[model samples]
Target chain A: MKTVLSIGVVLGAFYLLWMAAVPVMNIKWEVSQAQRAGVEVWLPESGIRAAGNWQLLSENLHLAAGTYAQEKPRLPSPVQVFAELWETTVEKKITSKRSLIFHAQVTLSATLLGFAMGTALGVVLAVGIVHLRVLDASVMPWAIASQTIPILAIAPMIIVVMNSVGITGLVPKAIISAYLSFFPVVVGMVKGLRSPDAMQMDLLRTYSASAGQVFWKLRLPAALPFLFPSLKVGIAAALVGAIVGELPTGAVAGLGARLLAGSYYGQTIQIWSALFGAAIVAACLVGLIGFAQTVVLRRMGMAR
Target chain B: MRANLNASKSASWAKDLNMIQPVIEANRLNLTFQTNDGPVHALKDVDLEIEKGDFVSFIGPSGCGKTTFLRVMADLEKPTSGTITVNGVSPEEARKSRAYGYVFQAAGLYPWRTIGGNIRLPLEIMGLSKSEQAERVARVLDLVELSGFEKKFPWQLSGGMQQRASIARALAFDADILLMDEPFGALDEIVRDRLNEQLLDLWARTGKTIGFVTHSIPEAVYLSTKIVVMSPRPGRITDIIESPLPKDRPLDIRDTPEFIAVAHRVREGLRAGHGDEV
Candidate 1:
């Protein structure tokens, strides 16, 4: 309850601040540009009618136009942005105005797919590397080194390489997410798999159980407590990878494309909205993985 | 079928009622480890035999190779030179045949599994069906007086209960021989005494041959039919004392003069092994 209230107050404050600041920032830019003689800028006045929702919040926050203020800003006010979100999200085809939701879906698809692939590959590699000394000595160093190269540098190269090889769209973005996200899963799972002590192994051995039985019964369950936390980290990393994958390519739809379109068209509202959407989506994805971990572990009788 | 059952019953019955071959026989068993310091002879040429239904124990100071001897018989360590036979088969063969079970000093229960799950582990490994495993688990839990603790994890249970669960694990597979390396050595006196009494009842009911290791003289005398006192620093057996106590179930065996006499002899054997005159 405390967290929810705090978050509401903070988000509310940010909205009000953004409402006042956007017009002021826009009006100043307009005047500077007007003086420069190169272009004209649009900015709303500081009055109750011009500030809009700031007018509704209180008179103390009311903004009257400064001497430098010009026409209304192109970007919507805070109330207008919320109205846009409500209209576009629930009523109108939101993405039709360069469709923010469609782009989010595109990025989300790549993020989810890449997260799945990366997590699967990472867990498999972790299990192999943890169990086998040869794999640890040979494969692990290279797997770790694979992550040292910056993802931004790798993103375009990945797109270019995939483009040359007839792969494009979601696959390229997912590959990028997988590339960035695999390391955390491997490291976390390796630690978890090795968590069982020698005595536990001997107990299994004394039962005359096979190596496979020991792993399935003992090591696998032991690894779970460590695995889920890493999965959350990996999923968030995967989303970042998807977004970064978008910046390089000339994609028409995705959170990245919406960001690019907003920047190009000077639609700061669209960019901020897309950024917020991306963050919320990433949080939800990570949260979903945690929920799955809880459910699966609870079913296995290891709720803690 | 009835005749075969009678024969099988008599086979185990031979240990108690008839002069039969020992259930476990270790002849001149020697083990030397290649250590950084030097080749340490962990076990000297040790000869021992344990009859079926024998509650035999090996008691000595630490580094006495009592544990090494147990490990040799369990086939956990390859002896430098030795021959160990359990139920007429070599130690290796007996291990492959799953003819014996082992318990370490600690409970050694899997932490992630429930107490009941730990007991069923060996049975599961041995490929028993689910129903058979369940039935055997219940029986063994009853044997250890842990019938209601089936679903509790090892950490949730008291140390004594966890140790009893481990005992259940050893007995679950129905192995004829049980090798215990000071199982009750870590428990408090009260819990240890309770476990010792229950262990005797288990031995009486199941007829499993037990070879235990402990430092407690009274515990050794209370539990074992024969106590093997050992001297350390390249361990050698100093004395093997046999008990002549009554076989009837009585909880006050410790207070009896006869039990006291047996315990006194065991103490003397231990003292002599420590190089003090008994």
Candidate 2:
């Protein structure tokens, strides 16, 4: 209940700030002389000529209401963005290209595919790194160094190279996502698999347990607490990687394409709505992983 | 079924043969650890023999090589010189044959597993069938007086209960030899006394050869048929005292004159060790 109340307080504060900032930030729509003739222009470009003009403006015009209700302003208020979101989602059919849900579906398919691929690749690499000395010594430094090169610079190169080989669609984006997501799993899992102390190792040795038994019974279960948190971070990174991959594809689909289209057509409202949609998707994905974490940890008797 | 009968017959024949041979024997064992401060002798010229069903306690101050000697017997550490054998074979071979069960200072129960699951760990690794594993787990939990706690996790139990569960884990495989490193050292005096009594009861019922390590004089004298007193600095045994206490004794035995006499000797041996260093 307290959490809900806190969230409400935060949203209300932001709304009030947005209302005050419209006039204070001087973000009124620029009126051509012809448009100015029909509508009363408060705070005209020429400075206020009289104290009576302030009264006239306050009585006849509401700059805050007008700024928020504009067809296009420098910054669209939260109301306009939400209204656009409602229209794109409910008023338009989901099959329509203009619908936000259609674009979200395009982006979500890639995100889910990329996330699964990334998680698999990460876990496999981690297991190899933990078990094989050669992989630990050789691959770990390279994994760290891979992250140093910016993802944006490499996204285009990966797409171009893959296109040359005729592997054009979702696979390319997923590879990029996998590349971004695998490092955390490797680092976290290496530490997790090694979490067993010398005494625990010695206990297993006394049992004369085989290597496979030791891994399945000890190292794997010990690594689980470490794995879940890394997965959460990896999924978020995978989503970002998927969206960035969309930017260079020049495709007229997905939230990335919506963002690009919004910029090209100067639709500030569209850009904001798309950004909110992507955020909502990321939150839901992370929340799903969190739900899984609780159930698994509880079954393991490790939950707090 | 006929082969099984013959197998038991041969096992009893092996036991008859083993009657004369000590279960664990050490000859001039020396282990020197190479550390940043140069070589530190963790054990030196340690010679001992533990007969079948004998409760032997190694009591010593810190760095006295008591724990180190136990580790060497468990094959956890390799001796730099000399030799030791378990069940007439090398430690490694005996370990592979599962000749002994070991308990450490900490309970070291995997928190993720229930008490029953932790006990079943060894059985599972040894590839026992599900029924046998369940049977053994139930048996050992009964042995440790934790019969009803099969499903409780380690954190759900108190410290004393957790230690008992760990003992049950060790006993699950029914090995003939039990090696314990100060298994009750962390408990309070009251709890420690209770565990000591319970442990002695367990030993009597099971007739297992037990090697225990501790620093407490009363703990050593009250529990052991033989007490091995050790000292620091080139870590070696200073004295070995044989206790004349009866096979069946109670907690009040610690107040006996015989018990006090043995504890006095142990304390003197410890002081003599420190005196030698000075």
Candidate 3:
């Protein structure tokens, strides 16, 4: 217990140091933008955006919350913005039915569906290219080329095309997610399937195992290490793709929609909060995938 | 030496060892491989017969078609002009029925599978029941002296241990014949000697017919009841030496005059097969 406590204190000190640096860093980037916008010198000569009360970490404390800091150059304190985080997430429910949690649930549903569809398609294509000689010859070149085409430019086109064809709402965004997510999986799985040496393949042939048996017994299991890292990348890409799809078409309810409103109305705090929210969401999803990787491999007795 | 097989053709091949009745008969076997430059004849008019429970080794120089012969028996490559029979059935028919096990120069183990799982692979493919597969795996693992390494990955083990695991895998399904191509070729000399002794012990205990291909003459002489010597660049069998050394061999047998004599004979046979003066 004492050892744990000591380590925790060290980590606490590091976090405090980090938070102390963050307000300045955030303001510096913002000030550069403000300067580019040709704003007059809004803050004091000291580059410190916080006035006098410069508490680094605690949400309850900051430069703006102090008395002497009132007349100095001002910026939103960590206290005020963090308080807004709690209010927007917990207290400010939409008719007590919808909040950040509800919005997260909605977005997660679409993201997961997209991830599943993307992974399945990727696996099928990889298997086709691996097993069918014609597909390997004809399809692989196009698959490589598809990844090079910018998905950001491609996402809007997909959304518009789907809208025209009478398929709209969640599907357009899901299609975009699949488009971005599958390439990594296909590439990873292909490398993995080919990873077995010639001797290993000969061993399978010696037993007269069918093609499917060779895949299930050898290739598929061997692909696991490559598959997991790619899934993490693919899931993150899926989230980014869903967000990009929202940008052009103007969807409501997702964090993307929240960003558009914030940017349009000059709600910098709200926009920042939404950006943080999206980061946290993506982190959680990737973390969940990592957790599953550990559990599944451990259960299969593949991992030590 | 089987100059006896060089039948005065026409009517004699039919009378030689009852012709079509041997367990494994390769008559006028030829395997041609087409490379970019031209067609290369890997095996030329090679003929041999292996009866039940015979331990045979094909030994020759580096470019000799010994390994090619083993590959042919496994039906991994089709012969250009010849017929091979495994128990009266064609090589392809026997392979489709999973009639034999093959061990390669490398262990060829899947790194993802543990030792036990690797051994269970052939059994799984043969569609044996779960309990049966596990039992057979345990039995063969014990046979190979790897009973405790069931859960260890191939990469975690030493090369010798991995090779032993592979040997266990081939034996786990109780296949009647084993086609091993330089199975201990990668091991250190000490390990190779140990595995050779163990392999002979295995052959004695199980009574499984073995067809091994090796470039080592002493190894072929030490383990085989019969050593077949071949030459390549026109791959054909030039000598078939029936070992007069007693079947129960030990490491100390190498120091004996008889073992040295057999080794001398194998070397001469290899040289003669390669068209070099012996």
> What DockQ, on C-alphas, does every prediction get?
0.40, 0.84, 0.44
Q: Report the CAPRI category for model 2.
A: high
Q: What is the per-residue lDDT of model 3 for residues A1-304, given as tens digits with 9 covering 90 to 100?
A: 9999999999789657745555543444344444578754244456435533232223222321232122122233444445556777888775432255555555666677788888998889988988899989988788889888888789889998999999988888888888888888888888877777777788888888998899999888878877888899989988877777777887776767776776787666666667767788999999999999999777555677
Better of 2 and 3 by lDDT: 2
Better of 1 and 3 by lDDT: 1
Clashing pairs in 1: A43-A71, A46-A63, A46-A64, A46-A65, A47-A63, A95-A99, A103-A254
Better of 1 and 2 by DockQ: 2
lDDT against true structure, model 1: 0.81
Q: List model 1's recovered fraction of native interface contacts, to 2 decimals.
A: 0.33
What's model 1's lDDT at A28?
A: 39
Q: After aligning candidate 1 to the native by TM-score, how far in Å is the CA of B247 from where it should be?
A: 3.4
**Model 1: per-residue lDDT, tens digit, B231-262?**
87577787888888866646687899999988
Clashing pairs in 2: none
lDDT of 2 at A29: 46
Q: Which segments of candidate 3 are over 4 A away from where they belong?
A: A1-87, A90-99, A164-166, B1-20, B151-157, B272-278
The sequence of per-residue lDDT tens digits that candidate 3 reaches over residues B8-106 is 562475556444466688999988999998988899988899877788999887767888889888888899998888867888898888888899998
DockQ of 1: 0.40
Number of the predicted model whose TM-score against the real structure is largest: 2
Scored by DockQ, the top model is 2
Candidate RMSDs in Å, in order, are 6.1, 3.3, 7.9
B34: Cα error in model 2, Å: 1.2
